[model samples]
Each structure stands twice: as structure tokens, then as C-alpha cells.
Target: MNILITGGSGFLGARLARTLLAQGSLALAGAPAQPIQRVVLVDRVAPPADLAADARVQPLLGDLGEQLAAGALPLADVQAVFHLAAAVSGECEADFDLGMRSNLDATRQLLEGCRRAGHAPVFVFSSSVAVFGDSPEQRLPEVIEDTTLPTPQNSYGIQKFIGEQLVADYTRKGFVQGRNVRLMTVSVRPGRPNGAASSFLSGMLREPLAGERARCPVAPETAVALSSPGNTVRGIIRASTASSTEWGARTAVNLPALTTTVGEMAQALERVAGKEATALIDWEPDAQIAKIITSWPSRFQPKRAQALGLAADESFEAILRDYVRENPQAVKLAVKG
Candidate 1:
């Protein structure tokens, strides 16, 4: 039950590590069983203070590509690997070489490491909705479904799609039990923004709630798919434990999402933190951001995800409520614009 989590310092990765730590402690104490025994966090930088202090947690700081190329990755005795490391859409789209090296090349190296390890760990990949291209003319299907062939229009999406294939092919050869979870846009994320093209999804809510100005890079009417941080973590963990027999032909399953407009999201912020919080948002659409955001699928019929017991925020309002609950100090009811 030794587990390795790459990209363990980023937003989603950090949260996942914390959740695993809590779960791991409970399991070690003879409570209900948890899937992990030893947990390792691998990233370019050390994990956050809280995670770094966990006794069961070990932080491995290094460049994954460099380490993999040098045959220096310490992959022995690892029973599961959560490959969550990758450059985001905005960054990847802006820098082609960096995207290829970080997203695709590094993934290939990791799969090779697993193959060479001789013990096939359960490999769970953190893929994204970016893998899917624009929705077809008819309202883009309600759910993206499991069988859709990826037609990625952006460099980031293309890289992720390639990674999915790598996982599937490696698994087919019995090198590892691979599961790729295509995460929806995670919203109301705690902390500062990263370079993701979808950063605005969390930005519009986070900044305003802090009584600071937040820009809505896309139009208010732009309908986009979303998931909460909690649900996204759950999907990743489920991928680790799900039996290969139950996985079937869908190597990559789209996680459930709540489809809503930017305007609706702002309204939810207003409901939770008052008009002052809503006032912090100023609409200033950037064409590049708009283009990327609009091209992404706005709706998905995640029936496969639902059947797999993956869940999502019931509505944007619930997402906001959860954000406020999770970060009450950073967000207050004060009417400061």
C-alpha cells in the first residue's frame, strides 16, 4: 500500500495529499481500512508546511523528467502511483516545448519506470476535460460519456489525450493497472491562482470573497462545466481502489460536473458573501482566454461517472458555500469592494 503522488505541491495535489494523510492516519490506528500504508509526495518543490510535517508523508523534490531520464526515480516497492503532475492549459499552450516535455515525455518515462519496476502498481492519471474538443452543434452532449474519441484542439488537451493512451496501452500489456480520470473544471479552489486557462473559474469567486478585485476573463453568459475540490479528490481516490474488472472499456471516464454560467457563479458568490463580494468582480474579457474557455465542452453526460459513484456539486451555490466553509477566514461577509 505504498503510494506515490507526483505534482504533490500544486492545488489539487496538495489537497489530495492532505486527504490521504488524514485517511492514512485513521487506517493505521486500526479504524476503517484505508488504501494507503506509506505516502510519498513528489514535486519540483517541497509540499506545504502542513503536509511536510505529517509523519507518514515523505516529500521527494526533483525534476521528474530529469530524474526519469537519468534512471534515478525511486520507484521500488510502490503499490500505487497517482500521476497528477502536468503543466496547465494556459502555460502549456504558451510554451510548446515545455508542454511536451512536462506533460507527454515525463508521463512516458513514468510508465516506463513502472514497467521496469516489475511490480505493476495501480497507476491513476489525472487527466482533464481539455482532452475533449468543442461540443458538437447540438448543445454538446449532456455528458461527454466514456466512449468519445478525443479530438483535442489545444496543445494541453493533445498532451493529456496522449497520456491517456499511454496509460491504456501500458495497462493492456499488464505493466500496471491504469485508470485515467478526466477531471472537470474544479471551482472555488482555495489559495492563489495558477496559470490554468480555467483559473478564472476559481478566481471569480475567490478574489471577490476576499474583498479584492477579480476579473472575469470570459463573458457572464459563458456556460462551463465544473466540480468541487472535494469531489475531484474523491474521483482520484476511487480510481486507485476500483477493480479493473469493474473499469471495463472506459479507461478514461469524465467526472460529474455542474454546468453553469459565469453570471450564475457571481450570483452564487453574492448569495454567500453579499453584494460587496460580488462587487469585487469586474468583467474584462481577454480574447485568448475567451477563445480557450469557449472551445471547451460546456456540458457532459457523465453517466459512466455517475454509475461509478462519482459525485459533483449540486449547484454553483453549493460550491460557494463549501468554499466559504473551507476558508472562512480568507472570506468574510464584510461588504468591502
Candidate 2:
């Protein structure tokens, strides 16, 4: 199977590509006749050096929106499309035009390209929980089923919601097999910060454990829904591979996971990394970030995602432990809170 992953250079996209390559090789090697052949990485910037070394991997550098507009993407014979490209919340909120072009227009172009391909490729979109907007008057009824209509509050959320609709309409028209996964804020990301409003969620823990100071842009009590990077990737891949019959809704479904406050997360970090790392976090609230964070839902009961076989971390401590295990260097920085 030929696979294409847009935004393949970004943290989530890069991790997913790596996972696919590793898994695809094992799965293909076991098959006597049918073998996975190629994986394409498309992004404005080049992927990391390690990914480029894989023989089966092909990295394409260019503006996806422009490329799609000019009919430049080579979509023929491609079995699946993982559309992870987008302008993140902070970036989008900072620059409206960039958001529209990257998030909305690019998606439309991609769908059009899929339609023009003449084959129904499995197109999996990485959406976000931001589509929920501020807490509803009734507070989501403790369990948000698959049928809830998206009530987007921000420009980024609005764009993502639009992208989901486009994917659904394209699927409904039999042009593509679409699956959208509404991801929660992924934490313990290993890398420099991107412009996501929720970057602090990971940064507060990641940087401190790296023996560096990390800033908390919100108060300790500020709560948010979260998932580990590993689980988020699993959910994305599941959406791509699952049969349409199994995927009842063309609309996006939230990935089930734990919800915690900044204080709880700090406590988890303290438990795993020790007090020294926790002390590295400086409480300096940014009103802009606070408003955005406040508007997001802190708790979610993703019944459909659970029934669909998606899983998540049981607690913030588990997530922190996984991060430490994945990044052993953090152990040296562990100190008492």
C-alpha cells in the first residue's frame, strides 16, 4: 500500500510516519506475496534526518495548499491519505489568513484532488477537540456521543469543523473513504515548541524533565483534556485502517482519555521526575492563552471512540512514566518537588 502523510515534519505527523514505517515493514515482511512498498511524507519543511534515511520513505517539500491547487500531488495508486497538516491554534489565532489558507482552503483542494483521482482512497483527518467550543450551558451531559453537532468557538476550531464536513461530504458522495478523529491535547511531546496554545501542557513537564525551565501560561488549577502522544498516533492509524462499516459516522469522534488540571499534571511530573523538575515550572499566566484554555472542555466521555476500540492513558502519572521511559535522559533531572 502506498501511503501519504501531510505535515509529516510536525511532531504528531513525524511520529505517526515513523510508527507506520516500522509496523508496515514487519507486516509486509511476513506476507509472502503482498508487501507494503512506499510511504510519502509531504510538508512545507523537510522531515528529520532519521526519517529521510528509510528507503521506503519519500519526503516532498512544498506548500501543500499550492501544490493541491495546481494539481501537483501525485495521488494515483495511493491507498491512503493521512491529512495531518494545519495551522495550529496559536498560529491560526495570530494570523487569520494563514489559517484559512492552510486549514480550510488546503483541505478543500485535497478533497478535490481525491475526487479527481477516480479511486476511493482512505483519507484520515487529524481533527481536534477544539470543535466543542466553550462548555455548553448543559455541560455535555457527562458523555458526548457520536451525534453531537460541532459548536466551534475559535477560528481554528471553525476551520477544523469545516474540514470535517468536507471530508464527510466527500465520503458521502463516494469520492473517498473518510475518517476524522478529534484528538485531545497531546502531551509529553519530545521536541521544541510549536505555536499551539496547549504547548505549555507538554512544555511544563517536558522542559523541566530536560533540566530546563518551563513556563506555565495558565494557573495551576486550569484543567484540560489530554492524551499521550503514543495513544494519539494509535487513534489516527486506527481511523485510517478501520473498515467503513465499522466506522459508523463520517463526522469526527473524540478520542477517549483522562482529563486533568495543570496542578494535577505538575503533581504527576513531580512524582516521576521529582521536586526539582516541578520547581522549574514558573507560574506566569498569559491572558490570551488563558482565554483560549478556559474556553476548551476539560472533561469528555467519548463513548463512540471507546466502542470503536480506541484506548488512552488511565492517569497523568501513567503518561509521565511513559514519557520518562521513552526519554530516559529525563531520569537525571528528576528531583524532589
In order of appearance, the predictions have TM-scores of: 0.93, 0.93
lDDT of 1 by residue, 1-337 (tens): 6778899888888998888877763221123455666778889999999988877688888998887778776687777789999999999988999999999999999999999998877888999999877645433444466776677878999999999999999999989889889998999888999899999899888988787898998888998999999989988887776776656663698888888999999888887778888888999989999988888887777776777787777888887787877888987556323
Question: Residue 333's C-alpha lDDT in candidate 1?
Answer: 59
What's the lDDT for residue 37 in model 2? 74
Which sections of candidate 1 miss by over 4 Å?
25-35, 135-143, 335-337
Those runs of model 2 whose alpha carbons end farther than 4 Å from true positions after fitting are: 25-34, 135-143, 329-332, 335-337
Model 1 is weakest, by summed lDDT over 10 consecutive residues, at 25-34
Cα lDDT listed for each candidate: 0.83, 0.84
- CA lDDT of 292 in candidate 1? 83
Model 2 C-alpha lDDT per residue in residues 213-285, reported as the tens digit of each score: 9899999898788999999998887776666667786778789767889999999888876788888999998
Write down the TM-score for model 1: 0.93
